[model samples]
Target: MEEIKLNEVEPYVWEINKEGDMLVPGRVYGDKDIIQHLLDDVKQGKEWNALKQIKNVACLPGIQKASLAMSDVHPGYGFCIGGVGAFDVNEGVISVAGVGFDVNCGVRTMSTPFTKDEILKVQEQLADSLYNTVPAGVGSTGDIRLDKDEIDEVLLRGAKFSMERGYGTKGDLDFIEENGFISGADPEAVSDVAKRRQFKQIGTLGAGNHYLEVQYVDKVYDEAAAKAYGLSEGQVLVSIHCGSRALGHQIGTDYLKTLEAASKKYNIPIRERELVCAPFSSEEGQKYFSAVNAGINCAFANRQAIAHLARKAFTSVLGGSGDDIKTFYEIGHNNAKLEKHDVNGELKKLIVHRKGSTRAFGPGRDEVPEQYRAVGQPVLVGGTMGTHSFILHGTEKGMRDTFGSAIHGAGRAMSRKGALSCCRGNDVLRELRDKGILVRGHSIKGIAEEAPKAYKPVEEVVDVMHNTGIAKKVVSVLPLISIKG
Candidate 1:
């Protein structure tokens, strides 16, 4: 790999000016070293390299601002990981690449009143309890079984369905993004095949990068924000990271062929196969968008049910009531959401696609919960099992630039195949055990594929978020136990 050129527009910002068919310039957020690493990938002639994907996204119609990505940017199916592209509502296209196969794959963090010391005392028991309680791994099924009609209810109502089903309390909805379920989700828009896949899968944690973890706050960076968000040093937190499971994947798979034909029907240019899309107002687009909303609701319900399981695990192990644990925040990463943002001087509704990016709306936004509106929306960043995860807040600059988006995780430094060759499951398990982190998984290969060394340093990734004024750090948390799928 050799060095490639890019124009530095500002400190920590680089731009590939619009050319040929590009509708907007390509912008990236990273320091010189990080940018150089991306450039090296582009120089290597990798087909899906970050720079190429960013450029390809720029070529798409209706894109607003610039085709943007965070410092953790890396090659993805179409857009790079850490990508953000906001498009005009009327002229925009809703794409499957923008929302990965998992569909609303997200993180939900819960805070407990108990301190880390208390959790540490019962760590082993809690680990065992959660491991046995929450079903995980490939094709994992859970206690909640629903028929086809019931599956439609979950798709339509999301977390509300969970609360009504006694999976959680009603108050849990307030802390979730979009109040726990996206409205305008028509279950009819979702294919019957997709609904069938989710009958018994709701609440199960699917394999590959999905996890349920026990973590404790290790440090606080912003005292006021931390206080407002109800965090203190050594406080224990639980993070559930998964998505809509098989249903979402099937939606993406089913839509790809639908949109691929529609793209040609609509005479839309295609730079990448995963970039298949239909105009937002087109019949096909509206249906796909509605289906995506259903997928989003499925994920919300999935997390809500898992959160309930986590609360039960704590109550059973620690002799406490379920009310002791409260939801911190719940937000998705892979999504194409219709949101109003200031474009130039006027506010306009745009469909914002954040792939491997979390929405971090800054202070004063009505979308932010009233309790934390003065600070910002809570942004959950998931680190690898062996590293420290971070809690961050949205910044005004992020709203202005990256569509209120931030990195979702440390971008993969190696592929799963690459990692497996060098890291053994037992060896990785021994390493995490040495650090006093307990891990339980249904598959050893799953553990080996997600070894910490296979990912970039978490601190380095979050440093870019903090330095670029995208998402400010609130606190850092260390893992006590992780239940991996």
Candidate 2:
């Protein structure tokens, strides 16, 4: 690992000074405990870690401000898991590691016009309904079967296509980020193999860290913001966490070779294989970026279809119309979006790459939905199956410092191999059941892989974000039932 020195710029903030081949400094947001963990990893001789990745990203062409990481910083493919980097459109490069293989992998939490008490009445039945209704596990296939031509439509239209196909409602668009469709997506940019992978996988919940959890608001931190989001104590909600399924992964795989070749062609020095990228204005760069947007759209469509399936399952067991469950807010953590931001005194367009980091736009941003403009965009911070999740609001400080990014979840404390080595899958299931929580997983080993002990304490993680004014807490939710893939 590279020896990186951190100088405290402020409480909960650290900076790595510009050094050899570095174009910008590296900035990390974390408290003492988090920083110590990173230091510990370095001391243990881990070659690939967040600090090193942060430094590597700073060396990339056209990187702006700083190579940033939120509180949940952890070693990832090229960028740190909670990494955020904004680049000049003309001079910047697009890295597959920044967008991640999952593409728009995110969380969509829908608030139901019901309470925990109501959910408890049919808890077991509801769990069964969800586990059976939604497809899960590796290579999970959904009921939807789209032809090649229609697959292109899903790439272009996103959730709107799902709605037109009788999944979800039109009202869902406003609550979704980018109105559920990202512009500049070219279906033709995506390969036939990627499209074929999505033929029957549109609505499936694929394995690994993806799940649908039924949660209830346990506490409210901001009354005004909670009210605006239609959340109150004991309110039941469903949060779907997944991404572009197979299509996203296929795109990432297909583009890796192209970008690697482009990296050499354009003379862009590569610090890591996953960091191979082309200048954003270059031919190969445009193709990969366009394909990535298509993957984002594919993810939006997947979540929309799954959310509607969730509605049906909820109504079947709990007795209500689909309208009873409304899309509270849908946002992705893995994305590369082109937007205008303040660069010094001038407004400049930059492509912001956020991996395992949510877009947390603060109040007064025109991009935020009108209803949430005064408060800020809702940031859904997911927790573990046995722990708590959070709904936070973007902060002005966050936008100014972090390119409007925040942690996605309690950063993983243990790898799946580590978790499986010590924990038993059935034991994990039994423990959750003993805690009065219901869990349905297609693979028991997957359950053990996500054992609660495998993650950092989410409460501790959120406190850092709130204390730093990166993102403020609005509500805390506890899971009643979870469906893991």
Instruction: Give the per-residue lDDT of model 2 (tens digit) for 112-155.
Output: 98889888889999999999999989967999999999999999
| Model 1 stretches astray by more than 4 angstroms | 1-4
Model 2: pairs clashing at backbone N, Cα or C within 3 Å: none
- Model 2: residues >4 Å from true position, as ranges? none
Q: Name the top lDDT candidate.
A: 2
For candidate 2, the TM-score is: 0.98
- Candidate 2 local lDDT, residue 176: 95
RMSD after CA superposition, every candidate: 1.3, 1.0
Ten-residue stretch with the least lDDT total in model 2:
1-10
- Which digits, one per residue and each the tens of the lDDT, describe model 1 over residues 271-307? 8998898998899999999999999999999999999
